[model samples]
Target: MTLVPYQGDALAHTRTWTTLHDEELRRRAVKAAGEKDTATLVSLTLAYLTQKGGSGVLTSPRTVEAYALGTRQFVEYAAANAVNLLRPGRHDAQHYINHMLAAGRKPAGVQLKVAAASCLYRALRWAGATDVDPFRDASVPKDRTPGIVKRPPYSEDDLQDVLEKANTHEKFLLFLIAHAGLRISEALALTWDDLDEQGRRLHVRSGKGRKARVVAMSTSLARAARQYRQQYGPGGPHHLGGRRATPPEHVFRYGSTFTARYHLSKAFQAAGVTFRGFHPGRKYAGTRLIQQIKDFGRVAAHLGHESVDTTRKGYAQLAADDLKGDLAGW
Candidate 1:
């Protein structure tokens, strides 16, 4: 019943548990909980939740992994300090939050860690393992400092430089984010079948919140897709992949999301452009589309936002800048 190190991928652990039969999952949980050890108890409960679809418990793979890591942190903290995690009270939750803050963790990071601990307790309660929820009303500190300074969207000239210097695959990725306004995750999740050659559209099967939509592709992007397909052979379900003859299920096979970002950043560096991650491309696309259409609702729909308010809030700075000229004439 030794607690395993939590360094490996939590998603991999979740996926393994999810593929097991219910009885097997229960057997594994039982084996892990050979004793009444608190760490083992938390691990077994998480395993059970991962196997049972995590409904009200763990939501997505990212969330599952985040919670698992957070729980391990908490469990390690408890073991070190000789605190009883299984029956923790509100004070214990507050202490954990304060401890993370004292360790120089960012306020947002501390909040997420607290949230993960809260979710773990909720899952344990649902599994009938714990009766107390310490994080139910824990007073987590707010990030009162001025919000993070987001890097401004690339200027037209810088964007042009990026487009000119990008290689074939890199160019496609840039176009998807910059011109089409696809989020990095959405762009990476695209497949050859999502492309509509006749209609010149790209279908986003499942976007944020499991919503789906179709977005019109620029003529240049459509032409590039056709050329890319012809040159590399039609990719697998994912629109991008490794240089090998056979494509994988995902777009970038560079291990993880961070690796993909590193490659993109390298391309930007090579182009002599400031690299601010992919979101700036999306912001550039949104700003340009808003100026072109002059319709917030239309812009919202194009960006796959359920509400125009959301779109407006996200682009408030751009909106203000766009209105300056109109206000000057008035």
Candidate 2:
């Protein structure tokens, strides 16, 4: 079997691959069969999935890219040791994990890399491109760091202080994440049209796994958004920072996630609060919602999670707080 070189560019490949069928995958397998090196074979598999949308196996571009990167790392490691990535066995998987540990990669980072490789193998298997999944039984290292300190949620006073310190742009971003329980990615992805003016709901189009959901906006959030629109002209594609944007851009355009984090940290420091991260705002929202509603399912839905268990795991510490209150009553 001779693997033909992928002839598609990034944009075309992304658009075309989402609609791939099984017959096309079989044909692709023939084209990929001639590749002698495991690197090429791994690359071919990723290209096919990237183009084919991984048939729900890969979920999103970010996920596919992560897996591709992980597979590349594995392939390079295997090549140095004269091993074939495509035909790797359990021992090869273990060796890769050991190598990552030896190279000082954090347990969580190595875990993600291993998961990425596992996902690639799973995708290939689903596409009928390969039968071997070396990472099937790989033992991912656990973080043994003592006394892992979880970030505490900002108190209401702390949150308000931070908000008061932030400029309009920063305030809006913080409010959306803190009040609405939006991930930074989701808040940034919002467009003007995603807001239902009359209905008072926010349409989150790019939740994890690219799931879309409509979350009812609080009266305060709705008022803030309206005020923001009036102050900043609403001609742009995005509701936030798209006015100066070329076209079809995100709302708040930081250069990168790190830049956003830096701005957020600055805001917290200005307010004289300890800066944990924007995620603590999410934790604050989760804890409040779970406490108020006492319904994990409702909290999960509000947070755009697929399962209540996810919501529970995130806000489990709140349960301890609840128990403390109960103990006081007793």
Best by lDDT: 2
> Each prediction's TM-score against the native?
0.73, 0.72
- Each prediction's whole-model lDDT (CA): 0.66, 0.68
Candidate 2's residue-wise lDDT over 175-265, tens digit each? 7877788887788678777876568888999898778988877776777777656555356334454333323444554434566788788
Clashing pairs in 1: none
Colliding pairs, model 2: 1-34, 2-34, 3-31, 3-32, 3-34, 4-31, 17-51, 17-52
lDDT of 1 by residue, 1-330 (tens): 265543445455555455657666555444433333555555654655555543523355556667777877876777676666556655887888889889899888898888667766655554454567887777767765422133356778888887787777677777788877887767767766787756889998757666889998888778766765555434433344335332454344443456668767777888898888877777777778777878878777877888887666554235447778678968
What's the true lDDT of residue 162 in model 1?
Answer: 75
lDDT of 2 at 311: 76
